[model samples]
Target: MPLIVFCGIPGSGKTTRALQIKEYLEQKHKCQVVHLNEEILQMEKKEVYKDFQAEKFARGFLRSNVEKNIAGNTVVILDSLNYIKGYRYELFCLARAAQTQHCVIYCECDPQLAKENNSKNANNFTEEMLADYNNRLEIPIPKNRWDSPLFHLRSKEETPFEEIANVLLYQAKKSKDPVSTAPEIKFEINFLQELDLRVQSVIDELVQKQQESIQSNVITFSDCTEKLMINKQISLIELKKIKQEYLKITKHNPPKRIEDIKNFFIIYLQKVVERF
Candidate 1:
């Protein structure tokens, strides 16, 4: 449950450091590392970096992948120019919600040298783009909880593999041990029961609405076909199982708002229904 984020300019050796960390974690710790660099490279091959919207889409895609991967006991390394503080905050929220540990590695580099390095690379950014990115970069501060445990490294500095490994591995072990003040499992029984009821209620309402639409002859044949597909895919037992799985997932990271809870139930139901 370790998320290592790399933050730096394009030519700041962020990728190199990420690779070094990935190698060390895999070799020394025998840990699986999900490198976002490969994903970014795939996106680059698709030219997803050409447009701002595409870049945002790529980030969201990568974030979802990270979220899914972090559900298990693997290490995630996000190798990118994580320049936006808000984006980093979003990542922090994801890590917190998933009960994972995360830290940022900032690769500090001189502008002139960075530009010179960029000039030597084939996939180099234009001087104008690099300047724009630099202007837009929001450096992570230690005062922010999300940016705590921040590790700083100069462009030419050797990667401190052992130090980082110890911090992540040992801290993860400490966190895994249950806290003395942890709430009693029985205390959450009532909340889980209520959540289960709410999930069932939402599914019941959706089925009723679909039946009403079909009986009222308001839906076309194609719509009926789609409804039938969903109905055939989501059996009552399967729906109940899905609800149970959702409850288990949310037990640790429950939705905070009433609307969010309802929305979560509906969205999860839709996802499960669509899978078939």
Candidate 2:
């Protein structure tokens, strides 16, 4: 249930960090992992944000895809600019609605380095766009509602993958998924809790950091069901189990808050264990 979102400009080492996290999570935790950049975009053949139409289309699709992936064994790591504040908030809402646990890793690099990396990449974005992003980018001040766990990597030398690994390992410890190979699933829970607290500490953090400019965009659970059926990703039996077991666990009393989501998942996992 770990949804790790990376936000940075085109050449800010977001993809690099994301790959590092993916490698560590898979190698250290032995948990099934999915790289959203590779899977959701390149492999899944999904469109990405470029203009208004493309960005809207991709954002909607990305949100749904992230939620779906969380229902599986793989912990999904989403790599994107996620530059828009409201868009980031929407992600928070989606994860909460799905009862999935999440963390945010903000990758920041020197503008010089960012520009250099952008120029080096064959498919790198336009300089104008990168310049605009850097100009207008509002760094996320800690906020409770988002439950964002931030790691500021400042080294121009390298991304301190080892330090980031320590933080992830801690969070994994807190997750305490017995089968999770992540070194600190249980510890991450603590780290995340602390991060959330820091976000809450700032008064009017919501307004100060709110991503409210965007319109409401939501994909219903019904939509998810349709997609699953059409795609045939899960068996009919598994679908039935998800419904029956989710209903049994939720007790018709749906989750109202992010924390309640933990119980919903615990129930889901319990059902899986029982079946085996």
Candidate 3:
């Protein structure tokens, strides 16, 4: 499997190039393509790209979708204005973790041309929004590891279809090996017991502090130099919810050593509590 990401400003023909590649892959290589587009997912542009938090949520949702679907004879195509380098890096990491190769197809076009095209289509992107996006755009650099294997398409006709298809298909068809995954890690019974005990102790301490009407306090986790800081009033329900999330995260990728468990949990608490 391979992930082909299309990134550009509105009206740069990202969707067109994505669909072109999708057709070529399907017809030539018999590849099953997963075309991911904001329109396809029924997301409102004004809502999703409204603010930092909204964009972050949208990106997280798209990343989760890629992670969930990138398996078994599928060629994933993410079509969007992926103008942020940091977000592109996250996608690269996700592809690596899934044991698949990925590439970016940047659709380069004149700002005026893009604006005209968008207006002709009656797209949601306003002139101000498009200009802001252009100003904020971090063009892909081939020197960066994540941005390597990048292709440029100034127009639909300029798409590097053959080269892209070759890169994505060669290893996929050549290798019969299954997707590589990290070996399952087993936590010892003693370590598990301690984990539960310490987690409960943390919850009780925080709940007691809340009951006592403490607005802010620093709580120490055992055997760690770092401390947990609670700056806002948190309810028991919220605390329990955070606990469940912590458990879920730890379950997937547990601390390598039992000694590190307390530190890990404390760090996790600091992050989750800071939002409250």
lDDT by residue for model 2 (1-86), tens: 56777777778887777777778777876767778763446522223435555655666666668878876667788887776554
Off by over 4 Å in 1: 38-41, 45-47, 177-276
User: Which candidate comes out best when scored by TM-score?
Assistant: 3
Write model 3 residue lDDT over 103-173, tens digit each, in one string: 98888889998888888764368778889898988799786556778886776457777899877878645
Candidate lDDT (C-alpha), each? 0.70, 0.55, 0.75
Candidate 1's residue-wise lDDT over 63-137, tens digit each? 788888887879989888777665676677678666668888999999888898878766667787788778878
In model 3, which range of ten residues has the least summed lDDT? 173-182
Q: TM-scores of all models?
A: 0.63, 0.56, 0.64
Better of 1 and 3 by lDDT: 3
Q: TM-score ranking from best to worst?
A: 3, 1, 2
Candidates arranged by lDDT, highest first? 3, 1, 2
Q: Which model is ahead, 1 or 2, in terms of lDDT? A: 1
